[model samples]
Target: MRAAALKWVLWDVKDTLLKVRFSVGEQYCREAERMGLSLNPVAVNSAFRQAYKSYSSRYPNYGIGQGLNGHSWWTAVVKDTFSLCGVQDSALLQTLSNSLYHNFCNAQNWEVFNDSKKVLEGCSSLGLKLGVVSNFDNRLETILKSCDLLSHFSFLITSEQAGVAKPSLLIFEQALQKCGVSAAQVAHVGDHYINDYLSSRTLGIHGFLLDRDNKYDRSEVVPKGHRLNSLEELPSRLQQPMD
Candidate 1:
């Protein structure tokens, strides 16, 4: 058997592999309307960003062994999001939370990037093991399976399962142990600069920043050649000598 060029490649889920078809605020608006709360998309979106940040900051150990289940963690975010939008009724918040959570679970709401599948296949063809290290919840497995992306990965490690989020060395170390390889033998690809690239790099893992949209200003932040414009470019980049 041919020796694998790299032992494994870790991936990030949201924005990296699968993306929501509509804006978060738009999704919140539609879900809110279903729960009888009429809200402006712009206002709801703004409120959601703030609410989510506040909730996440408050509950650092949500959803994995720290005592919060998926429903509770997500419910808090949804409830806070609607409350900030001025809908204070508990009944409405509960209903909206359930609706929003399940709605997002449906695969139709997400679309995989055009280059995602082919890139995974390319890495697999190169005899590299693949895994996912994400900050999302357990529903990710269902989402990946629903999107037909589950087969390519040898493992999926989420912050929820690992008891910590990205940029946390513990989570990255958890992935390293799962793959049974040293940091130098692995590569993680994600869209976030600090969370995905720098975090992995700090742990001695080769990290590639997937900048599909070209939205980030690379000025003095990331060193040259570490930025990837698309998943299709990954294979060649991985073949080059690491810095």
Candidate 2:
């Protein structure tokens, strides 16, 4: 069945609204340099990526589901990443891990997309309720606030707070509850094909895949109307009638 017209707009944080200055690998290399580790940036980054893939695949939620705090969960990832680089110094690993964690918590490490604020303001002006549904930790709220985008949202729900991540109906349900809207009345805009688009659509929420880079291959599975090149296109898209 066709979903109801969108009334609430839920956003995904990381790539949808904000983009990091460099890869997580680059961030780790910078931290290593500051700590006086004479490492090959490329090699270290490659090792870190491999380590990250292994850990994420193993724990999925990176132990966040197992009661690991955001800081501690990330510390383990950092340590493992550096360990693969042959850095076995316990004290140094801890220091580098802590640095990486705190570094990302800073707003300077991220850049808000140029169109993000304008799109947010436009949605707000259209009387659409806005919120965030992300697989992020609480640092999401802080990041948005620092970017001056926090006031636009009615609520920010994170995986840490919801006790689950996206693609799970539970997290999206929490946002629906907080916004006082039914799934049919909301549209989720995000970059990830599965996490943002399919997940929302499967639950009867309108899904708009924000393909800013135009990277996704079009398929019959993804309705043409659901793919957007920019949030700026959202207001216009919302005005269109749903079948």
Candidate 3:
């Protein structure tokens, strides 16, 4: 058997492998309208941004630091988002919030990228181990399962479980331990510049910045060689002498 350059590939979940099928606002609008709440999608989008920012600031990492669990934390954000859009009825708010929280847990709200599964298979066939190192909550397992991606990863690590989020080296360290590999033996990939790329790079793991949207096309922070527009580029990149 040919030896692999890297022993493992640690992946970032959201936006890297899979993502919510619709924009949060669009999904919220759909749910809200079904519940008889008239709302403008644009308004919901704007409100959602504010609500999410406020919640994440006050209670980062699904609010584990504040003694809050993922459900309560996300529900609080959902409530605030709708309230900002003038949802005053407590019963209706609870219903909408609960609905969204669970709805996002499965394939009902998520979709795997076209290149994700193929890339995963490619990596596996190369004798490299695969695992996830994401900042997601506990629902990550169920989401991946629902999307038929659970089997691709040998292990899964989330911020809620790790008690720390990305951009913090602690989570990556936990993943390295679980995979039984050193930083130099693994490569990490994600869409976020700081959380996914630099954080792993700082810890001595090779990093690939997945930029499907061209969001960082001109940014000096992302190296041209490391910026990937698709996972289709990954197999080839892995075969090269990675930095």
Candidate 4:
């Protein structure tokens, strides 16, 4: 049977279209060395990655259960990451973590994915409504604009604006509302299996998983969705009708 054509393309920004560099990691490691604490860049990077995942997964629940704000949620994880790394100075770690705000705010600290602009242009030319559903702070618009991709999206919904993150139907729903499309008519593309694929699928939105790192095994049955290694592949995927 023929499938429905996709009318809207929803996206996840960080790690999907943008590569976020943790400037705080290098800054913190330098501070740790100055304080005579041993810190490995690889170890810190690994710990920070795990900490970010844990925070993203746990914070929404924390917001629901304990009424903790997102900033506090993230701060707690940053503190824990430093503590677990055996950094004894709480004040220094706090200072370094706070420094991350600078990196995130500065456009120079991030690089737009190699294929992001091309995919965006192709989708826009195809007349598909483009929107961003990202777990981000208020600086999301500025970041996108800095990369000259802000004009490509008709709707830009961020966690700070939506009061919820991806994997939460509210975020996707709000984006769809802005685009004036139903969940079933839109398709979301992102990197994470859970946040992008499972979450969107549960809401009846089609999912396209991007395996940028080639970490997922192709032989393993990809869940009922399209999978690609880069945004460069998105145009062709979009050319196909949605199921």
For model 2, the local distance difference test gives 0.83
* Candidate 1 lDDT, 16-122, residue by residue in tens: 99899888899999887776667899998898899778767777656455578677898888888888888988987888898888888778889999999999999
Model 4 residue 100 CA deviation in Å: 1.8
Candidate 4 residue spans exceeding 4 A from truth: 1-5, 22-24, 30-39, 46-58, 61-67, 79-94, 219-225
The TM-score between candidate 4 and the true structure equals: 0.78
lDDT of all the models against the reference?
0.86, 0.83, 0.90, 0.76
Clashes of each: 0, 0, 0, 0
Clash count, predicted structure 4:
0
Candidate 2: tens digits of C-alpha lDDT, residues 194-243:
89998888887888999887798867335688888888888888778743
Error of 2 at 141 (Å): 1.3
Over 4 Å off in model 1, which ranges?
1-5, 61-66, 217-223
lDDT of 3 at 57: 93
Q: In candidate 3, what are the lDDT values of residues 1-243, reduced to their tens digit?
A: 443358899999998998878888899999998997778889999999999999899999999988998899999999999999999899999999999999998797998999999999999999999999998889999999999999999999999999999999999999989888778889998999889989999988889999899887557444567788899998888888767
The superposed Cα distance between candidate 2 and the true structure at residue 189, in angstroms, equals 0.2
Quick one: ranking by lDDT, best first? Answer: 3, 1, 2, 4
Q: Name the Cα RMSD for model 2.
A: 2.0
Query: What is the lDDT, from 0 to 100, of the residue 36 in candidate 2?
Result: 82
Indicate the worst ten consecutive residues by lDDT in candidate 2. 58-67
On a 0 to 1 TM-score scale, where does candidate 1 land against the true structure? 0.91
Question: Per-residue alpha-carbon lDDT of model 4 for 23-96, expressed as tens digits?
Answer: 55665576567656678877877777778778767766335345665456666767777877876677877765
Using all chains and alpha carbons, the TM-scores for the candidates as numbered come to: 0.91, 0.93, 0.94, 0.78
Clashing pairs in 2: none
